[model samples]
Target: MSTAYVLVEQNNGQLDHVTAELITAARVLGEVTAVVVGEPGTGQGLAAELGALGASVVVAAESPSVTGRLVLPEVDALHILAAHNPGPIVLSANLGGNEIAGRLAARLASGVLCDVVGINADRTADQSIFGDTIQVSAAVGGASPIYTLRAGAVAGEPVAAAGTLQTLELPAATAKDVTVVSATPAERGDRPELPQAKVVIAGGRGVGSAENFKTVLEPLADVLGAAVGATRDAVDLGYYPGEYQIGQTGVTVSPDVYIGFGISGAIQHTSGMQTAKKVIVVNNDEDAPIFDIADLGVVGDLFDVAPALLEEINKRK
Candidate 1:
């Protein structure tokens, strides 16, 4: 049977949720083999969890010095391992994964199914694209086809599977030219990561000011245990961090529920968040474009509606 390699991601010894989702998708394709690129202390029981999720092979490279270094070794490993025991390759279609996918496809000289929402292999490789528009079936040339899966696009299910562990120890490659810099993780609440969050509460310019924005959206996210996002207008006006923006100029997310306040939906803006499973729009203008795609819409002044909504949510809590 063909083997599918799922590159595992761990932060502070805990597996990233995207890795779990990838393993779940791998079960639908073929035998799953997990690859972990970190020091021994990082994975905890993540590997075992992946095995329980149907991964039959687990590969580890425990290099302490190489732990956070952005090196080309990952792409190099893909070329080396797949050359001898060639099969399907799976990676999270996040920012980091896209970089590795590009390098691996170039080095391996193979076709890449990138930003693939879902993958199916019966007679051909069928993949769903971003922007909620296209689905394409693809073929590879001489090498095994590499694929990158979108976050939150598929449900994760893990089955019982005994895994064979392998460690391919390669000599450390040259460090990246970028200088070592002090790293500080941003302070956030217990909220879920933005892309992986099931619920997203967002703001826009209509919230009036930076202070007003927190009044409207943050409370809702807190109630829902959701991540906070902003429209390009809110981001440009400095009402929220640029990282919180969720339109064409911002991050693309497919959360279960998305709430947009005061944002006039431009196609560019919608292009990023249109994949959301449910959308709620609150704006003073009933004719606003954001309302066009909203499953639920409220045509009222945000200044009046937001406080009431916040109070109701607080009362419910």
Candidate 2:
């Protein structure tokens, strides 16, 4: 059977949720191995978790330069491991993950499938293309294929493995033309992150203003413990932060439930979230394109429907 390597990502000292999903996806292709790159001791701590998700072996590489220099550090580590044991590589479809996948694929001279939503029974990667109006399956012939899977594409199930952990020695850092001089952390809040949240509640141009978002959407999001999202129009209007914008040019998410308030569901916006398992839209315009994809549509003013829904949810709680 084939062996697939799952590159695990972590944040705030815990395994990134996508790691589990990658492990699950890898098993679909073949036997699964997990590769984790982090500071000293992160791999050992994460091995058990990766194993529980069906990783037969875990390779951990320690590097202080991981977050310091861009994607080279990760590519260097993968190059070493792949040299000895080459196989299909799976990674998450995020900013950093895409960079690493691209560089690594170039080094390996392998074809890469990006933002794949599923794996075919024949191991080809399934992708949503052209604003999700088309679906395509791609296979890499005569070479190991690198795949960057969208976060939340695969539902993870724990299937225990031996959980063997091994350390990979990183090579000397290569000279770089550019340097990372400074960085600022994002604002931290109690809510789950937009990409990883199982439930996402988003506001759009109809939310009116930032104050209205705070008054209407914030409470509903708080009650449901969901991450908040915004459309490009809302973000341009300064009703929400740029990071909250969901579109082809913004964050891509595949949540279990996506609830949009006053969102018209432009193709740019739908491209980012069409994979959601259940889409519920609340918009006044009955002809809004969002309802075309929604599993449930509430054609009413969000100001009235949202508060009433929250009240009902609270009463049930």
**Best candidate, TM-score:** 2
**Candidate 2 error regions (>4 Å):** 177-181, 254-256
Q: Write the per-residue lDDT of candidate 1 for residues 1-317, one digit (tens) a residue.
A: 88777888767677877777888876766888888777764433566777787788888765665544674656766667777787778898777788888887887777787766677764145565454456687766545678887776666777878766777764565645233456787786687877788888888788878887777677777877889888887888899888877865466778889988888887656866788999998999989999989999999887778778878887887
Which residues of candidate 1, in runs, are more than 4 Å off? 41-44, 122-130, 175-181
The top-ranked prediction according to lDDT is: 2
- Range of the 10 consecutive residues with the lowest summed lDDT in candidate 2: 170-179
Question: Cα deviation of 287 in candidate 1 (Å)?
Answer: 1.4
How far is 250's C-alpha from truth in model 2 (Å)? 3.4
Task: Give the TM-score of each candidate.
Answer: 0.88, 0.91
- Overall lDDT per candidate, in order of appearance: 0.75, 0.85
With a 3 Å backbone cut-off (N, CA, C), the pairs that clash in candidate 1 are none
